[model samples]
Target chain A: NAGVTQTPKFRVLKTGQSMTLLCAQDMNHEYMYWYRQDPGMGLRLIHYSVGEGTTAKGEVPDGYNVSRLKKQNFLLGLESAAPSQTSVYFCASSYWRGGPESTDTQYFGPGTRLTVL
Target chain B: AQSVAQPEDQVNVAEGNPLTVKCTYSVSGNPYLFWYVQYPNRGLQFLLKYITGDNLVKGSYGFEAEFNKSQTSFHLKKPSALVSDSALYFCAVRDDILTGGGNKLTFGTGTQLKVEL
Candidate 1:
């Protein structure tokens, strides 16, 4: 099965442009997250969904919005792209939180490289 | 606040030799630690995690992590390094209070591991 898949693997946009990055998982996981990877910054959480129809803010949610209307899909939107938002974006999903007693392993999708000029 | 730290920016090891990537964390309550690997231009892959039980946790690709509660560290290790093991490694943590139903993983600045043949 395609564990986790992201659409538009690469994209370039000018400042003020808008776009959406789509993430889908076949694992039927309950938790999905959007993260951005920057040089020397590791991965910063942008947004997340605990379940379908429930979305929440993450550490770096300032420039992004997320929707989890379907169980398998989590969409990240850039209403107004900024140069600062240029980074590799990743989507991950996991069965539950914590470990041992919970399925805390997060399966990630191939990243989307976004360049905002 | 909760955070993770990878003390080394890069680690160099010879093939067939043991390798260790250091990771330490700071969290308010009990910490749920994780290790992930990222290949070039790809998303992070789950390596392993430490939740409640054992101090040593084994994960995919023959990687494992040792959790030291006193030091608040979860260091990733491999018995024998392979050239294929050369990649960026990240350490992450989830605080008990910030569990938020969804797993909010706070990641450290990654450390690049280079295994020389």
Candidate 2:
């Protein structure tokens, strides 16, 4: 299985530029998440989708939007890239059974490095 | 809100010695804890998770974690450290009751572990 894959592993954009990061998983998972990794900040959740056609805001949802059009895909969009948006973006997915006690494992994608100047 | 803390910014251990990475969590209900490791230029990899049952959960690459309910901590440990084990380690917690979802993971600031020979 390809597991989780992210497109445009590296990208650079100028201020006000717009772009989308694609995340795909072949594990048939029901939940997908977008996170940004900064130095010493670990990973912060940006947005998430419980399933297709469902999306929710996460801890750091500002300056980002997400869409889950298909079961296997989750897209993160930046309408106007800013320097503060420069970071390593990671995509993750997991299958949900019930509560935290039911399932909690998350598989992550290779990550995309985005630099906005 | 659920949150995690990795007190140490960096940990250094000699190869072949036991290594410990500290992690503490705060949540209202039962916590589903997880450990993830990330190498340079790579995505985070699932190390292990503590859902229920045994307090000591063993996982891939000779890594393990102990869940201490009293202390509200889930610390990652390895019997013997190796140079290859050097990486950034993160502790995450899933708060089902608060988030009302199974996919939300609150990650810590991350701890950088360096195993030297």
Candidate 3:
């Protein structure tokens, strides 16, 4: 199983352009997340879905949008690319149980490098 | 709100020497902690997690972390460092909020570990 895979490994967008980074998982996970990694900024969650047709805002979700139309895919979209949005995007999937004690390890995709000019 | 901190931005160690990367977390109760590694241009890989049971959790690549409840720390350690182990390491904790039952994770800024010969 390709635990998780992301499309468009690298992309360059002009300011005000739009794009979407696609993430897919075959692990049958119930949780999927989108994160951006910047130098010294670590990984900040942008959006997440607990299940198909369910989505939620995360720590840094202001500049992005997401959808989980299918159980295996999560899409992160940038309506208008900006220099500040230029960063490495990562997609992760994991199983989720109802309690705090259920520590499910998240599996990540290779990541997409986005450059906004 | 939940948070994680990787105190060091970078850590250096000899190839045959022991190594340690510190992490501290803050959560309401029963924090679910995790460690992940990232090679250059790659996605984060799950290393270890501490939920319950033994405080010492061993994980991939001979890495281990001790969960100290008193100090709210989960420091990663390895008996002998390998040059291949040079990578970026991250610490994360699950959100303590129980409203959504979505087990969201908050990550540290990351620490770069350099193992030299």
What lDDT would each prediction earn against the true structure? 0.90, 0.93, 0.92
lDDT tens per residue, model 3, A1-117? 888999999999999999999999999999999999999999998989999999999889987999999999999999999999999999999997655567688899999999999
Q: Arrange candidates by DockQ, highest first: which order? A: 3, 2, 1
lDDT of 2: 0.93
Model 1 residue A114 distance off true place after TM-score fit, in angstroms:
0.4
Clashes of 3: 0
Candidate 1 lDDT over B53-116, as tens digits, reads 9899999999999999898889999999999999999999874554564767889999999999
Per-residue lDDT of B21 in model 3: 99
Preferred candidate (DockQ higher): 2 or 3: 3
- What is model 3's interface RMSD? 1.1
Off by over 4 Å in 2: none
Clashing pairs in 2: none
Q: Which of candidates 1 and 3 is the stronger one according to TM-score? A: 3
Cα distance off (Å), candidate 1, residue A32: 0.9
Superposition error at B30 for model 2 (Å): 0.2
Lowest lDDT 10-residue stretch of candidate 1 chain A: A96-105
Q: Ten-residue segment with the worst summed lDDT in candidate 2 chain B?
A: B94-103
